[model samples]
Target: MPLIPKSHPRAKSLLIREKLVKGFDNGLVAKEGLLAQGRGEAFDYLLGEKTTKSAKKAIRAAAAQILLAERPVISINGNIAALCPKEIVKLSKQTKAKLEVNLFYANKNRKQAIIKILKKSGAKVVLGSNISTSTKLPRIDSARRVVDKNGIFVADVVVVPLEDGDRTIALRKAGKTVITFDLNPLSRTSQTANITIVDNVTRAIDLLIYDSKKLSKKNHSSLRKIVDDFDNKKNLSENILEIRKNLTRGAKIA
Candidate 1:
């Protein structure tokens, strides 16, 4: 096989892997995060590393849901912190949502590193810094349990980028409207979320910020309808079909 040039689509996926590796070395991402990135890259490659129409609709619906919430929060993990800190800041500002760090493999050093990164990204009110004042999120026994009282604990809606399945389920059981950005549409995080943006976080965050502003002027009823009409199973099937189409085309070309 010939070498993939830096400009190639496969090379872009490799660059994403490099970012995750560097993030882990910098103590901003967990070891498991590297494996997660590899999994996401497989889906990204199959999708041609581009967002689809179904994903666009889901992204807009997620933005609408965030705008309609009384108290919205944007949850950040180590991977998201390393990948899209500035985008997260912009999305939080645009949607008036709280920014909170929620790591699965929690440690003081890693948490502080992510907090510092977000603060430098112009985030003024990043929460979850004080784990001492945490409220129990039922069904979650991991470090994801220790959310701040004024953040995820009280949020009516939350956007979880690079989310884990258990935390997503716990948040829903707590009565919060969950929105997730996961490349794997079949993942539990995607299935459990009220609105799933089946796209890369690097792409989804920026689009969400833009779409939220565009949809902000919409009335409450309109936004509610957007949420109500969302069908996760249908959306997942759409993504699966797209993947199959790409595979079939590649086979024919070969």
Candidate 2:
């Protein structure tokens, strides 16, 4: 029957409907977890809200796999460019993955801006599409990216650092291995990925570079293992559980 004090600042984002109250009365244990929202407002969403030992292990495994791989690619988008430019470049250097700019917001100007940032960091680079792009869904088709069926698509592993849904699916269907950095585990992009690293882009990329640089030779089995181990259905199922279980959070704390 008690409630958090009105003075609590985090009360703003709360949307405790009658259903939650009813559940509480029904003896449902208070849910547990970090909220699913963009970073900063919700405890840095990629920090896992309440980062888990499992998520950490997954990230490390992913990094290790990439490090021990012969062919890998790091796909960059505007969000990644804006947030972790240096780290992106560093990982590319370490993994020797081709650095390619792929975005939902496609345009020649945007591509050039991303390229300019990467080139300044002294990283090897490639453009995802042959056509100069300034469009989104129109340019990068839903199931098919006008993306060179040759350049990035040919790589054994593709790291889509920050991505949208359609391209992730498209890349996999095109037969390229896909690794993605996504905070929302339930998202289509995350579930579809060969490796889903649920960590902050800045921190994750740094860890990835550190892991990749430690490798002396490629481990084809390791790469294949991640690809084989990932299960889209299970990932979504677990994430949904986490979301519902944690929905009854305490005083809003970012």
Q: Report clashes for each candidate as comma-separated counts.
A: 0, 5
On the 0 to 100 scale, the lDDT of residue 54 in model 1 is 89
- Residue 247 of model 1: what lDDT? 95
| lDDT string, candidate 1, 1-254, tens digits | 23448777467566667777777888999999988988988898888789999899899888889999999999988999888899889888988999988888989899899999999999997888885767778888988998999999999998898899999999999998999998988899988988888898887778888989999999999988987898878888899899999999999999
Q: Write the per-residue lDDT of candidate 2 for residues 114-182, one digit (tens) a residue.
A: 677677767655556456532232334542354444446566777886577788787777676677777
Task: In angstroms, give how far residue 237 of model 2 lies from its true place.
Answer: 5.1
Error of 2 at 62 (Å): 2.0
Q: State, as a TM-score between 0 and 1, how close model 1 is to the true structure.
A: 0.93
In Å, residue 217's CA in model 2 sits off its true spot by 6.2
The reply for model 2, stretches above 4 Å from the true place, is: 1-50, 68-70, 129-144, 215-254
lDDT of 2 at 74: 79
Give the candidate number with the greatest TM-score: 1
